[model samples]
Target: MSAAPPTVFGIARLGKRTKDLTKRLQPGDIAIIDHEDIDRVAAEALIERHPAAVLNVSASTSGRYPNAGPRILVDAGILLVDGLGDEVFEGVRDGQTLEVAGGEVLLEGDVIAHGTDQDDVTIAASLEIARAGLSEQLELFAENTMEYMLRERDLLLDGIGAPEVRTVLDGRPALIVVRGYHYKEDLATLRPFLRENRPIIIGVDGGADAVLEAGFRPDMIIGDMDSVSDRALRSGAELVVHAYRDGRAPGAERLEELGLGDEVVLFPASGTSEDIAMLLADEKGASVIVAVGTHGTLEEFLDKGRAGMSSTFLTRLRIGSKLVDAKGVSRLYRQRISTFQLVLLALAGFAALAVALWATPGGQALVQILGARLDALLSWFTLLFSPRATGS
Candidate 1:
């Protein structure tokens, strides 16, 4: 037979980019998967890429890892290796091969290591048993967590936005809040929602950049002291200062720097910027509040590295249907670029290159500079066009 495949290690760290992992996977590349706690949406996206084999980093079928990753991998007829730890991974890299026979794994380590081929029946049966047990646990865990967060929400906001406040203008519609980095991505997804009739735009801190870059202007800004620049704050948008739960207006210091105290609207809330935005829209009786880049899940909260998203989880219920998470809406309204756009853009690029190249003695130098600029522009563009690609 041809040379046996090299053993591969699976990573289980939080924030592990599954796309990156998928890119590294060659056919027959074995991966040690980590984190059984991945959400359904994220897990499905990862599994659709199709890695060869997966070994669960955790034993005991714990719901602590992503439920969907392992479950889908198992169902897709991929190998499911469980209970292997760091040492096992290291051993694989050190030239050991894993062999399973009967109901047990056999491994040998040396300059060149090998493993026994285990019976397929035993492997399938064992994986199925573990999957069944884990799926039940994960479903229960998600249900309980969602319920718990919803209950703990208002209490977390107490002495904060508990009293609530409104600042919407009589003639202005509710502001559509957005953040930077993925401005184009946000705009593309939001344009359909804003077609013809639209919500007044608002910027939270740096979100003003998001607004302007997307060719829109902010009607209001909501945040603490830092992030929002002088030019942005003076953009004639209404300013709302989100204070701490204890009523300490921390951002007031910056507002003083700009001499905007009289113009500031302070609302104390123990939630995030997006949360405050949603609350403001509701309190002001805005018809609807649409948010971009708003945190909507445990993974997002964890990505934020905060101990609790209890406030965000709670604030949603308070707003209920009045609030729309832009992320889900963005996904739904994502536009597919036709092959025509790609072909036309390619032709246009080639024409631009030809013109620049034939223009002057400095044409090549100019072309080099232009190329660099285009690369930078594309780098930024990908932040909107393909977020996963950037991470990879």
Candidate 2:
């Protein structure tokens, strides 16, 4: 006879890439990821998946930087187990039912691995330590930036090798969305900008889905096509596949399989999908580039967990003042109807209404009636107080 199974916390879903793993996650599932220092973007994706718990093979923070991902996970009421090590992966496969209790991972009532069960208190304290060690990280980041500039000086100094996209961006503002840092809130905040400007919308990977969710169709979709949905790909937007500098595009394989081989343009460049999207917009003569959910600060850049982010830093330098992030979107877009403008609009509306009323016989009669009523009220006031409106 088989032994009784231990208390089941959730069903386990395992994968090395947190982004890919999130695609398979359902509510009440336990996500097993190998992501190190999980960035804000990944955490947000995981939170949306509604996982009951997350068991990581690597340290979620590693004191590398004050990454907000771990804190985001804990705050969302999801259980987190840190640094379970590669041994956990050896035994665990995808879709295995497991129990997580008191920092111990149990498979069929047998303890297979142990880890640190992280909560808000633990994550907050680690973030403080990560902030203290940020100086070293900044120095390293500077070095990487210089090194990247040397490698891609042409792309940075001059707009070289940007793809010839079919979308007309000339003199029009471009809004690039990424599935990064507070994207939902940022998108919501840009509703005024959306209604007023009607900027060319560009989505990076899953951001296309986000754009659709926010009630806008992307004018262009740029990414490796891994995380994007087939529905987004078929949404009549121009697709730009990001390729490596060596001209290798693994994402192209998926596109071909979906019978969309002729529907894409390959943009071979280094850096991230977001970086390439900005470059394409800039080269296409966009009046300005507005970014949503992309990394902004030094900490967010490092939290992306790759050396290629140096290209994003340099991409900003390349795009220069034309690039605007979501935090500054409201400031740049104070183009909203000002008090003076509102007064002018109100006056124009009243003038139009008055002209229409005077042009109609019924309206003219109504206006004459109102005028007579006004004169009667004035005469009554004058009679009631003789020389003044009051007895005084």
Candidate 3:
């Protein structure tokens, strides 16, 4: 008879929203999410939490496009299982002990649901299929892009609809940070720029937390407020809620609960909060806008899984001339000071000081005292390393 399947055990953690779920995930916990065709950004977040395995209630990769999420998870040594349906949610509860034996999920030795065990081979096959059908996604993207331009032309061309915030951005560069991929690294690299220009800092959604993490308070926080923390919402930064076209603000209610209803300004617009922030900066006459952790590549846009990405594409097209990526700025703006240059500058300053000192009687006396101390230090060093000290 064949041996029974190997049961890998872990604590179950569930969240319907992958972004909110990742915040509470701990090492060795089994993350249960309902993410469909999980994007690279979500995969990266899960990887950060070091989960033992991920069990998805929906498709991990649909082969509609070559999403890098599942591939990233499997390669990072995290076990991925998908398509177990919503039955798993009903069967399992948070913090309960669960067993994953191949494609089957078990609780108390009873099978709850079964799914496909994703690996390098399976994910690779999915990516191959996705790439083969890339042309269709591109065609859809073109259609969406044209439709977006028409719907948002007034705001896109004239910056007509973006609401004004109290934060002053005129004639200065604005740094718009999003809590997306590689944001921490990009923020660290922009330290010099931050110190030099002191650009108006705007954080989108949870990006306010990122700004605080990087040791700066956000000048303004703009987003739907779904992912941001309560601390960030109360962080005293000017809050601009990204509301729907119908003027319904989800974030505003949360602020009201926090007793901050009077402080926020609702800005109704289409597209992602990332687009809203960039537009806001542009409308306020920011000389330049620097984006950190915002979508750039075609795959990234698709990974977002938003029809609003058409708005992002057009948003860039509208302000492409003034907007720059943080990576570009970090690469080009090399203002790092060298130790050798500092030493040389110090020597030059000392020489100038010595010359000026010699011109005055009191200054000359002070210089002589300093010169004696220097001679004594050199002589002591020389004596300490003298040839006579060696037995040879």
Best lDDT among the predictions, by candidate number: 3
Global lDDT of each candidate: 0.57, 0.86, 0.89
Tell me the spans in candidate 3 whose CA falls farther than 4 Å from its real position: 1-7, 328-392
User: For residues 1-392, what per-residue lDDT tens digits would candidate 2 score against the true structure?
Assistant: 94342333888899999888888899999999999998878888899899889999999998878888888898888888989999889998778899998789999888999988887678888899888877887677788788878877777777777878889999999999998776777798899889999999999999999999999999999999988999999899999999988989999899899888898899888778898899889988999999998876777778766643577878888889999888544455455678999999999999999889999999899999999999999999889887645665
| Model with the higher lDDT, candidate 1 or 3 | 3
TM-score of each: 0.46, 0.77, 0.83
lDDT of 3 by residue, 1-392 (tens): 95564467799999999999999999999999999889988999999999989999999988777888998998998889999999989888999998898889989998889999998778888889889767877787789888878877889999888886788899999999998777888898888889999999999998999999899999899999988899988889999999998899989999999999999999998788999899989989999999998987778878878643577878888887899987444545545889999999999999998889899999989988989999999999999998775565
RMSD of 3: 6.9
Q: Where's the lowest-lDDT run of ten residues in candidate 1?
A: 109-118
- Give the runs in model 1 whose Cα sits over 4 Å from its true position: 1-173, 178-183, 328-331, 337-392
Off by over 4 Å in 2: 1-8, 93-95, 328-392
Q: CA lDDT of 97 in candidate 2? A: 90
Model 2 global lDDT (CA atoms, 0 to 1) = 0.86
Q: Report the error of model 2 at residue 230, Å.
A: 1.8
Candidate 3 lDDT score at position 81 = 95
The 10-residue segment of model 3 with minimum total lDDT is 326-335
Query: Clash pairs of candidate 2?
Result: none
TM-score for model 3?
0.83
